[model samples]
Target: MAAGAIPATKLAYFDNMWAVQATATLLSHLETEDGRRALILDSTIFHPQGGGQPADTGFISGAASGFKFVVEDARLKDGLVYHYGSFENPQDDCVSIAKEGEEVSLYINPQRRDLNSRLHSAGHLLDICIRKMGLSHLEPGKGYHFSDGPFVEYKGIIPPDLLQIKSKELEKEANALILAGGKVSAPVLSYNEAAECCGGVLPSYIPTDSAPRIVKLGEHPGCPCGGTHVADIADIRNLTADAPHTNGMP
Candidate 1:
């Protein structure tokens, strides 16, 4: 099958599964009678921008036909992800489709993946940092930016004193842990262990039987996460906050 094509099932990236294989099953193939064009593939790792995250960019290739295509965009339709790409005309009489069970390789842009990974980890760090400051009432606002520079908005106003203190405290703590060479650990924990380590009950959204992955920053911070993170805290270069208010909880 052609590489980077949409698949019958969505592959989750929570465990760096994309690093191993980017191949998918050959579902259905389409083309002109003269073998001028074609579209085929089963599964893919090209994230299609959902849950406030951006779509992933990557390339696809077919070894037998020497077919290579650039995945321009990916989107979800009826719970299926479709990868859109282009290729040159063929010379064969019929547009032969790949066998239904064949596999193809998909190469994701490393730079784009790195950016998305960093942004996702940074968002989680920000959440934990806020909670550490004892601002229990504060919650993250909508419109979170995880690409390029990263930052989050609070739901309501923040007290000037609390904001100033938290701003400096979180910055200092995150940077210090980074400098300390803290490792990002993802140990699977039982329900009891997870609850004890995370103060009390797990979030309602977290599955009960699933082994929870925890991201820890030395002895200071630890939280449940399902996103990729730098091996060490030192990888995080900088962190800052702005626009603190004193109205409502965020």
Candidate 2:
């Protein structure tokens, strides 16, 4: 962790909250009680990397902290980052950590953050579409996609003809779901409920007994997700994809 960074404690994975305007204020120091770090910003669009998603890029600024501050890296540990940066002085009042209720203005690189958010949400939609095509045997391998576009490799063998049909059908279904204006909700479920929705067994990687957060895309698509998504499917537009093939398999 660097210096002058404010750790956001109110957010968790899959949150899509972002502030349009930047506001500077004061905040309490969690790392040290005697110390009070200037609350430089109120809201941020920076998306920290987690669940295979990458971190968001941005910058912060104010007189309390300094003339300017850059967010070099953003990450999540149990869900928080030090918002690392530098200040004019080690003990200066501007850099001195403050308690909550402190005001600050947060400036985020919106274009980059928006791109990442779209790509991540698109990935989840792809996953749901793939499963609905009766290709439950397939699992996502490497999912690499940025603001420009995204590509996902599947694990199972797919028949060439079926692949084309499935891809087209998936596009149609996904688009229809989006157009229907369905509400997307994330709800915590018990282990039993999670298993039942996942077809009798939870993925080995997911912890057992712990309540799982499930994403419901209308009445049809539902699955576990820990990434930010739009409030409605309609937010997604111009969605198109290359033909699915068996070429990526080993």
Candidate 3:
């Protein structure tokens, strides 16, 4: 509401990851340093690129106004979701067409979104497989869920001799669980409640007073996450753990 300040965009996808279309109000539009115009909305179904996932691409059309903005990329900065793209028809007064408080319709590319969600959920499924296979010692680390080479890294190393054996075992276990699929749920809870859902404690990086969102796969204990995921493990279809890559970590 301030001159150049925009409020945090409510994440509509957080409540419904399967939603591809949504209605939102135009909050602000500004040009980035790179010259790309960014559209901010009161709330967004667009999942900004983060949490090991790529951004969602889509188009926004103003209601009763022939203004069209193609969303090439979306990013979050300080809680604001910036829809980065340009107007369909460029003009000197392009900004004038996108008025503040005007209603707009948002539609995401469903095929791309589904693929991203499947890949992301598979990464978490791997974490579950690791725990089930008695490899609980390997601490979960960063994950790259991009379609090109999606992988979940761990903090510990797998010995060279056992790497091949473990890879096969992991792949078998992952697919087995996928066949025995279960529902997945993500909910926002208080720090204490979230810890209980996440087995016992949350990561230290999470603030004590903050209400963290926890994603739970079926009856398994939950994990703190802030990304869209499939409604069920079965939706992941299948999983194949290619090989284990280890660094020189102790």
lDDT of 2 by residue, 97-181 (tens): 4334545555666666556656666677778777777777998877765655577777887776676777778788777766776
- Models sorted by TM-score, best on top: 3, 1, 2
TM accuracy, model 3: 0.95
Q: Which stretches of candidate 1 lie over 4 Å from their true place?
A: 1-12, 17-24, 28-43, 75-79, 88-100, 141-145, 160-165, 185-197, 207-226, 245-250
lDDT of candidates 1 onward, in order: 0.59, 0.59, 0.89
Tell me the lDDT of model 2 at 78: 39
Model with the higher TM-score, candidate 2 or 3? 3
- Badly placed stretches (over 4 Å) of model 2 are 1-45, 82-103, 188-201, 248-250
Clashing pairs in 3: none
* TM-score against truth, every candidate: 0.69, 0.68, 0.95
Top candidate on TM-score is 3
RMSD of 3: 2.0
True-vs-predicted CA distance for residue 201, candidate 3, Å: 1.1
